[model samples]
Target: MSTDPTRETPHDLEAVDRDDAYAQLVARYSAPERVAVALDKVKAEARRRAKARQLVTRARGGLLHNHTVREIARYFRKAERGRVDLLQVSEGTGIPLTDSRQVLREFVDAGLLYEYAEPVGKEVRRSYALAEGGKGGITEVFIETEAASRLEEQENRARGTLGWGEA
Candidate 1:
């Protein structure tokens, strides 16, 4: 029984009214045990749906965010190993320097990148390389390749599902 008519199907509203009437009648004449069981069923169904929705959301977020981070880290590692500077990374990746720096920082924070200081005459210059456990210094290139491959696979699956061809 929603106040918004558009939200309440005719059948749904009828069911709600019928349920309300039954509840009033039960309170007046039915055994307390029957009412308690009915309420418990409703509560259990609501809990189940809520849990399902939460699980879906958590799964989606984990896939999207974790994949993005891993892919970005792989890109940075490849660029560093190739002797590409930050400017080159910005241009080649088509990500602005600021955003690229942020992504790189995350990899550093995650311990996927090793940071070191190269001493200059007056100031120290910081540089990065792949951490010992990572795929050496070629992580970025590998990640980019892997991501492209995955995307292609996804596209092919989608086309197959929809009866479409490569466009």
Candidate 2:
């Protein structure tokens, strides 16, 4: 009840002291758990943001269909490091080639698909695989010589003879 104009009122001082004390308590008690909880919240928010971005992209006429995306992702996931070209994926998933290409490009932009290159004849060919965690999205490009291609063709024929499924 001091009358000094410069002096903070008891209620004002109490409120600030209470806030500081609460902050100190939060920092000191269950600190690790609190940190983990905060981190989880941040990650969840980021995921929500990514989903929103996906939606917005679709709304903007970007061809971001959930069914198509899921089909493409599943196709690559099943491939499991094996590369598949666009035409093969399109045919397997029953999605048109144009739509498949757009979807695959979107997945690549979203960090959910990996694009790579392999040689076919004298020219290099582009292919794709599913991105896993943060490691699988990186493209692996290599040149395949004629001998290598011939060897691969022989292996592919051999696999065909054994009745293996294509990715």
Worst 10 residues of 1 by lDDT: 51-60
Clashing pairs in 2: none
Off by over 4 Å in 2: 1-63, 77-81, 118-124, 134-167
TM-score of each model, paired residue for residue: 0.35, 0.41
lDDT of 2 by residue, 75-159 (tens): 6645464668888889888889888988777666666667887889998776877654422322110011223334555888887
lDDT of 1 by residue, 54-164 (tens): 322332355323333444545664443733445555666666767666655555554455666677789765566665444432343344445655665688787775322
RMSD of each: 21.0, 14.7
- Superposed by TM-score, candidate 1 places the C-alpha of residue 127 at a distance from the truth, in angstroms, of 2.2
TM-score of 1: 0.35
Clashes in model 1: which pairs? Answer: 74-139, 74-140, 75-140, 78-140
Residue 145, candidate 2: alpha-carbon lDDT: 22
